[model samples]
Target: MSASVPTVGSWHRLDRAGLQAVIDVLWLVGHRVVGPQVADGAIVIRDLRGVAELPTGWLDDQDGGSYRLRHDPVAGTFDHVVGPHSLKNFLFPARETIASFVQLNGSWSQTPPPAQVPPLAVLGVRGCDLAALAIQDRVFLGSGYVDEPYKSRREKLFLVAVNCRRAAATCFCHSMGSGPAAGPGFDLALTEIEGGFACEVGSERGAAVLAEAVAAGASIGGCSPEEVEAARGVPQALAARMHARQQGDGEPRPRSLDTHGIRDLLMTNLEHPRWDEVAARCLSCTNCTLVCPTCFCSSVQEVADLSGDHVDRERQWASCFSLDHARMHGHSVRSSTAARYRQWLTHKFAGWIDQFDTSGCTGCGRCITWCPVGIDVTEEIAAIRASGSGAAPPDGAAPAGAPEAGETAS
Candidate 1:
């Protein structure tokens, strides 16, 4: 069916089959489509061959240190929130070889591998992850030193973002001012309704693909007024539902930490007792940082063959929870879990703003959902804030053995 041409930001309805056609068009154009699929009992992001790869009829239940996938035939393909993976894995892989060296004639010869960058179309990306992407861009691109590998992958990326229709128990993106709704930085944004998707194009590349889909008769032109209204209402309805859920049993609705004063709140509470309380439960397993989309810590290692004829230098994902992460000479700076945890929280919430002009956390809540000990960052911040004027240090004197304020041992 031929439909009216869609203007930028206007909604266009595409049925399930039409969505498949859209994917086909992208693949034909040499874009590797990456999307969510069920793997090992959880929704995982991977290279997709077709629409059949999506986790259709599956929804996730997430809470602190917990996640379970359930079959709900009525749920849309994009119904689930987030999984253990994020866009970071694609743009910034867990392990990468920076360079390789070989001993030739008793002399070392170094060779930098050619860059392997692929054009990518990421389907079903959520808004909070988009926000996380933006923060990462600042870190990798906007910073003084540019990560060439990250830049190469990002330059060819095409984003198909999905606005959230339902909030997970661990989600607080709305509180972080990131989403429940799709925002900027996407090529196409989708809101799934009954039997179709309400799509909006955000870039020239998005517009081109959408036009191709329409020309091929994969999409019906012009969304109805009611459909448009419903598409716009998706995030609003999610927000209301989240509010109601938080206010269970007439209790006060859980509010996000006041980010405006968070820097001061954490800076002033360096010696707070809550750190000890949380450290007791923290395993220092680094699950929280690994699952976090914005945590970009990494370490480099050199591997050599048995004959020592060749060596490869690799960059691997690292976490603040690791003792080696804070090691200096013969001593570890953050000897206790308390110091490491404190460093992570303060860096994400406070130091990040100073360095990047934005918070490192997008509030996707994966850190909470995947944490083995169920350590909630929101609750931790709340506890420290509730304890006002905690053991104030003397003027011009730092806490006895505490690292300097805003100093990250990791």
Candidate 2:
């Protein structure tokens, strides 16, 4: 095998054995490789020891509050859509101690997180999740205040994007304009075709990795023009199907979010009755916020040993749905469930744009599929739009016409 660094943007075809060589190459390069695999009856991102660990011949059928797996011998390894877990779980981990302080012998000590973290190579990254990474970049990196931990993990992340061949029922990336195809920010973007995968080298790192794979005996061959076009069509066809279905073009119920004036739509309709209606079904369980790719609400707490000698300050994922999310002086600002729900939705669609110049939601359908009660955000937004604006409820603290145009979060 000729070991050479594929130029950025080069196209090549990798057969099944060659694909495994790519994984082997990453492992040899000291990366902890992770990919999608069947676990607990769902396709979740997990550590991959080899290509066999991939969810081959397995397909996931996802819907509002429902996720099931099926086996298809002809299905590609990455045909399944996203599960509840995402890169957010790895990059911005569910919980971590940003800074820890210890006291003993009338002295105080401060310890920072370890700077050395193992590099990780993530495979089967859907375009929607890739878009989400950008959104988070704006928050943790682009934002004036940098979140060091998030940046550390993100910097070490090597993304392997997959051109989606199918979308789950709840998918609305077409409406959000986030996916159905891999965008920028990947090392290698793969399109699974008849005999193997067509790979596009996206970065210098990716090129170098391909070089290593070739040196390790991977079969990297140039793809013909027709084969490249066939590879490209995989994502294009999916996008077209979603677009047509979202337009109600002779299809059954379709999930979509209309973003035209979406900010003004939600900001002006705060007092709409849909809030109360959805809240009745809302479990306040934090499932939506947990699954959402860009929801960055967090909380910090201090831990002290019983001996009163050691203490640690930790931060964990938090949600606006929590009763104490906006608590100040032991009083919750959003005391009612309706108020909490309003805060999350408005922040995701409206306030986020104001803060980050982009909508927080990537329309990955994670929130909809993971919700126990199947309360779809797209449906709620449509209902609110249909109802126009409602008169402020009797117990409402804010006025109706201009009820909290922007949101304040912890």
Scored by TM-score, the top model is: 2
Clashing pairs in 1: 3-221
> What local lDDT does model 1 show for residue 300?
92
Candidate 2 per-residue lDDT over residues 1-410, each given as its tens digit: 22234878888889879889999889888999999989999888888978888888998887778888999988888888999899998888888878877776799998766566788999999888988999899999997999988887788889889999998889988777778888889999999988889998999999899888988888798777787788899899999988877767432256877666667778888888888999999999999999888888889888778987767778889999998799999999999899999999999988887888788888899999899998899889877766676423323454332223212111
Q: Estimate the lDDT of model 2.
A: 0.84
Error of 1 at 349 (Å): 1.0
Clashes of 1: 1
lDDT of each: 0.81, 0.84
What are the per-residue Cα lDDT tens digits for candidate 1 across 259-311? 44566668778788898999999999999888888899999999898999989
lDDT of 2 at 331: 93
**What's the TM-score of every candidate structure?**
0.90, 0.92
